[model samples]
Target: MWALRRAYNPLKRRGFCIGTSRACGAKSELGSCHLDEKASVGEAAQVIADRSLSLKRFYSTTGDSSKFFMGRRSFSSQAGAKSSGEVDDDLEDGFSELESPASAEAILESNAEDENEDELISEPEPSEGDDEDAAVEEPQNELELSDTETDVTEKRSPRKGVPSALFKAIVAAPGLSVHNVLDKWVEEGNDLTRAEISLAMLNLRKRRMYGRALQLSEWLESTKRLDFVERDYASRLDLIAKIRGLHTAEKYIEKIPKSLRGEVIYRTLLANCVSINNVKKAEEVFNKMKDLEFSITPFACNQLLLLYKRFDKKKIADVLLLMEKENVKPSLFTYRILIDTKGQSNDITGMDQIVETMKAEGIEPDINTQAVLAKHYVAGGLKEKAEAVLKEMEGGNLNGNRWACQALLPLYAGLGKADEVGRVWKVCESNPRFDECMAAIEAWGKLNKIEAAEAVFDRMLKTAKKLSSKHYSALLKVYINHKMLVKGKDLVKRMADSGCKIGPLTWDALVKLYVEAGELEKADSILQKAVQQSQMRPMFCSYMVIMDQYTNRGDIHNSEKMFHRMRQAGYMSRLRPFQSLIQAYINAKAPAYGIRERMKADNVFPNKALAGQLAQVDAFRRTAVSDLLD
Candidate 1:
């Protein structure tokens, strides 16, 4: 009646359900024990005992345990005295059948006797090598290995080097397999604890071997027998993240218990969606985890910024919509990506709204932020606004920021603001790694402020101890533009003396300046030397300057020779030079000289327009004669 009552009870059925009884040979319940043929109670109890003992040992070996026995107290107490004795008999019978209880008892008893073993094993062991390589205390959840396992097993001898107390404690541990594996890992040169083991698995995942990493993580989970099932399942979920195979990774993730689903894995799937630029897929993944209120770490959320920054603008709206739906707060980098991309494309309209979004989100822009705005101002040709932004940056102590400074310098130079350029230079003087100084000096030269530029130039020269061609060329232009022609010439002499190869532009500037200043002799000398040093013909500008010099000095003879040479050299369409030549010839009062005799007998005479002008000159001679007659 009691077995019938217990069998019929729904709550008891779960625990009592078992295989077919031997006599019935078909499935039957405990209530049928009174039938003519049945297996004795003793035999039924034996199977239960055998299963319980095996499960207990298995759970003890690995670190897992279950609570199936917790709610069975009422059933155990209600059973008859005979059933009670049978249960105890079954427990002993299962233990004896598997292994000697004495040995198991001895293992358990010895550990309990030496309570000091707990204290010893609880302390951290040192690593191999000297004091320098000794292990440091790890963070919570970090794995640590035993010294004896790592050190003693290698020599197949006791490691006295390890403090005796720690070694003995490790040897005395009841779970021998646990002790051995820990020691073996140490012997194989790993001295990691559980927390460290997890970290190592994380490191392996970073190396892209997801399969191998998952196996290692599963092994760790099995061994640690983690009390928190979520932690184990989360780790396993992370390991399958890189599988590209069809549904393999997803299938594995689904196997994880509902309570164990990890946010990182969901985020990773979301990231994959973003990677393929599939915003819809990403939304689906996010929505599934929405009820869990899965919040991503800063590192994971940052990947969204990268994806948006790489893809075209069309995808940005979709990505933003997904983020909005998920309530995923965009990081500072997200705003930065938008600002930078928009700034680069010169899409100022987008930038305005982005800035407002950043402000509303309370994301403060850094130097990068200001630099992007500065770029927008530059590309749109808003020089004044660009300068204002740069000036505001300086007021905020950002002048030394290299990107902002580089952007600011060129803007000032473009506007020809020597005073502002000078101001930037003065501010740069205090710092050793000054980038603005050279740009500022070049700006000063462009403004024709040689004195102010020279002051900085000299300081940089003395302080820098070396000068590049850019510095030399800038200084040369300043000297020439300010009418310091002699000083400019001296610089050329110095370049020649120091074996520096002066380029054609610098030589052209020097020669043009001398010719402009009425120093034809100096100009000719420099031109001849430049030809020899450069081993190349002088520029057309050089020939033009020489021709102009001769024409201005009324040397029509030499001027015509150079003009013919220039025309032969293919510089023929020079109208102003031809006019200068005509003026020079008229001024020399050589109209009677045959045009053929003057221009190498080629009959290239002055045009018919000049014939009338020549007639006036002849009439002046006749008027002089008539005046004498009068």
Candidate 2:
């Protein structure tokens, strides 16, 4: 699955068509930037919102979402600055408490038609809000580092091969607590090695079963059966942040032995803060690391890049300056972020120049970087440049990198290269990966080959016997694209019936399916259901889909609600949501009263495109007599 920054939007994601949706239950591939409605949304943009590095966060009711870094900026004024006909409610109350990230969550939980019918599947579509950088992003930094014990964790097979007895007992046990299970396993004199525990942790985290993972960590810590290394502490901190709130993780830091409270633990917390887009807290944590006189890692700096890439691009230069001061050589991910920023800005020359600089430093462009280049080149309408980059990705050796197929499929599809898509598919035809299959479905769907896409889905279902909702989402996307509402519904029904875990990606597909089918009410209902699930955050596209539909209908009231809900859901699309809100008011032949003030309250200034929309909205307003006298 893909983990794009921002939106990597279908219609608007700048380049690298992959979005956070790709990071669903499947492995999140790095190729796209986290991008947004306008620009600057990446894997971190939503969950690439992680760099979907490509950082990705998956929401799960089974446990806390794997990633989240979201909080509102402290505007000069917000709560005291309302220009309203109606008063604020608990939703705005959440936004008002800027200091505590915990108080900022304002999800409205409502029971859907099938609330308890079946368990939901893997983390659904990349929320595009989760900071998607799953690969070069945090998971690499957060979990598997070459120096850490978790390196062995990554080597263990993903889903195949024999699972350890500890794993079986943990899974077989009911509820998140597997103490009895662990006790029984130990009672039978089954030995527990750190490697075995590491493998079990890998399996649990992979399945997004963070609660059980936490329990496992707690058991390890409480039992003290094995020696605790810095990595063990770091891993536990990450799981704490992942399962508990960031604040809880912050508190856990004090519990760490002072000597063991090294750079890794603090950076882990910082990464979590950045993951949520909690700018103030991220800054505080980053500053704290400096106060402690710790050597800053590129991982830490990249965390800032991930944060600013979404919420504040202006601050990115500052982070770069610090990296320079600290002599932190830019990693491939650093260059990728820089390149993506330039690409998002449409500065093709700058992007290329960054690559040139990266090469000059002897850091060759990796597969993900090449993918980013192709994406931007296509976005810039430089077809040949894009193709040249794609050729570079293919290189002389097809077997050099198995993962390159994930990048290839989408870049080709973005170029509308149907033949190339199929050719790439042939190479992986012998044993396609989950992510590769996802890319093929997307590529085929983009090329309008619904049947081919469906065939891939069918094959995936048969091969991957217990496919997640993410798998279903691929086909659902195909159906939505072709406007086959009945088929889309049938697929969704089958997913639920099969007891696949419903998630953000699934919700996004459902919302799009209904919206495209002209059922705004149903679409709205589905979004509400997603909002109700505390662990999940809806994709920016999902909210935009319904909001835009309301704007089309000139239903300003519902549009405003969706807009508010979106902000509450941790999405801050700088333009699209506002444009929809204003357009709704304009279309309804009503004055967008105090719209400017509202934008100011959120620290959003109108650009040329927005100014034009505002101009139309302002034209209908009654001029004040006092202003005329003045």
Candidate 3:
């Protein structure tokens, strides 16, 4: 019996139990068993008794012994017994004798079984449809997670209202090749929305990737998938001209279907022509719009008016009459243009009439209108009226407006109203931008108030967080005008020490100062060094400076050298350089005729002014040679 007990303990630890009496088909008579079956029956009874003792111990450890007995019948029934009725009665009888606690190991085993059974009872099985859905969604969820991770890793999140994916794809495409990437996106079942396309265009434009922007616009237009409105077509045309030049834009307009070339498209093209100063193309488009009886907009007329106002002030009236004939109402811009034209021509009465007409038309004068009125009045010597206009601007919420204050200061300076200039400076001094300070400095410089200019400059230096080359240049100009060479030179040195990049304008100002002070050699040397170190290409102003100084000194050798340098530095097509060189050649009695041939070779035909100047120089040379021989 002791050996059987030892063997039974190991089997119980291993979760092996003896078969039930039901399995042997012998219920209700365990004590009356035959001797041959006695050993097996006794073992079975001992195993059942041990399991019951384990359950009681488990329940005592968990503090639920009564609940354990209550659940015992159900647990036994669920274990797939051979006979439910016999198994229930036997389990109840065994639990009834389980008052004594069992071993810790047996209790733990019974508790584990109870938890597993509870789990089986609590959890429901998933259906086949649910399994299929999970399988389908698994890859999709993984793909989304990977995309999110990639976005985080690449740091290509959306910015400025542009989508992350769209912006990243556009940036990844090579120069002007965004259309190819966009096509790939379409192939991948992703389509760009119109808003996205517009935003991409705007982003590319801001980045100055005009070629790629134009390509994208062209691609979008060619697809015919988008319902492009007038503004879209106009923006596209404007970009086309900006990227591919005006001629290409004209050709593109010609290629557009006649039916689609409505007034809006023609107006856009006309505006482009005006912007590029293609007067012929502008006129052609304007005539076409008129011939088609398309209502010409005031903006288009304003452009034409601006173009004509440059050379023919009389033609401005004709454009106005044309606008009146076409029943095209003049916008505020049109009135401003007319006011500017009349002011330039000294037609003060006409300007006043236009102002009254605008007022009659219920068009209030904006800040721009006030600025134009003041500028023209100043130009026409109406200082009192200009001051009134400026005062009106101040009353109209332009008080402390830096730009308005800047503009007014210069006008007051021009009018010799130093007190008014000081008052305007006070108004802007509270929070002066660099431009405003520079403008104030310039105003004081214009008034020849060197001390006032220096004071403003000093204040700017002390208050400004960041100073650009222009600010330095403005102060340098004041020093130059006053012939303060030592101060100007010291400022230049300080600019260099401070690592401020010397712009062309600053270099020009310094060179002009030196040249004006008769330090020709130093001026030339400084200009040469600046040209070498400057990241910008040498401008015509630099070459013109040296050429003018050398020619005036009759140093024809150096003058010609400077001319060749200008050409080598790619400043062709400027008539002033050629004129300077020709004058220097003629003055030196060298071969002056070769300049004309060179101009022809460069495809720059001498204008009437240049030709007449050349002829006069030739005749003067002849007179000088004759006087020398006599």
Model 1 stretches astray by more than 4 angstroms? 1-183, 186-191, 198-218, 225-239, 243-246, 276-280, 290-330, 367-630
- Write candidate 1's Cα lDDT for 1-630 as tens digits: 122112221122222222222222121221112112132244334323322111111111122322212221210111111211111111110011111111212112111111111101111121211111011110001111122233233223333223332222332344224345444556677555544554444333322334444555555555664453554554465344333321455676677667656664565455444433343344346444543555533323334443434322322333343344335566555565566556655567666667776776676765445655765676678887777766776756655454345345545655666667666665676662323455455567667776766776777666654443334555665665567878877876766674444555456667767876768878877766765675434445566667766866778887887777656544443233444565566666655344334433432233233333344434234666688898
User: Which structure is stronger by lDDT: 1 or 3?
Assistant: 3
Query: Model 3 Cα RMSD, Å?
Result: 45.6
Model 2 spans > 4 angstroms off: 1-142, 145-162, 529-541, 564-583, 586-630
- Arrange candidates by lDDT, highest first: which order? 2, 3, 1
What's the TM-score of each model vs. the native?
Answer: 0.30, 0.72, 0.51
Q: Give the range of the ten consecutive residues with the poorest summed lDDT in model 3.
A: 137-146
lDDT computed for candidate 2: 0.61
Using lDDT, give the best candidate's number.
2
Query: Which lDDT tens digits does candidate 2 get at residues 122-184?
Result: 222221112221211112123332243445344544642345677767877786558777877
How do all the candidates rank in terms of TM-score, highest first? 2, 3, 1
Model 2 misses residue 296 by how many Å?
A: 2.0
C-alpha lDDT of all candidate models, in order: 0.44, 0.61, 0.54
Instruction: Give the total clashing residue pairs for model 3.
Output: 0
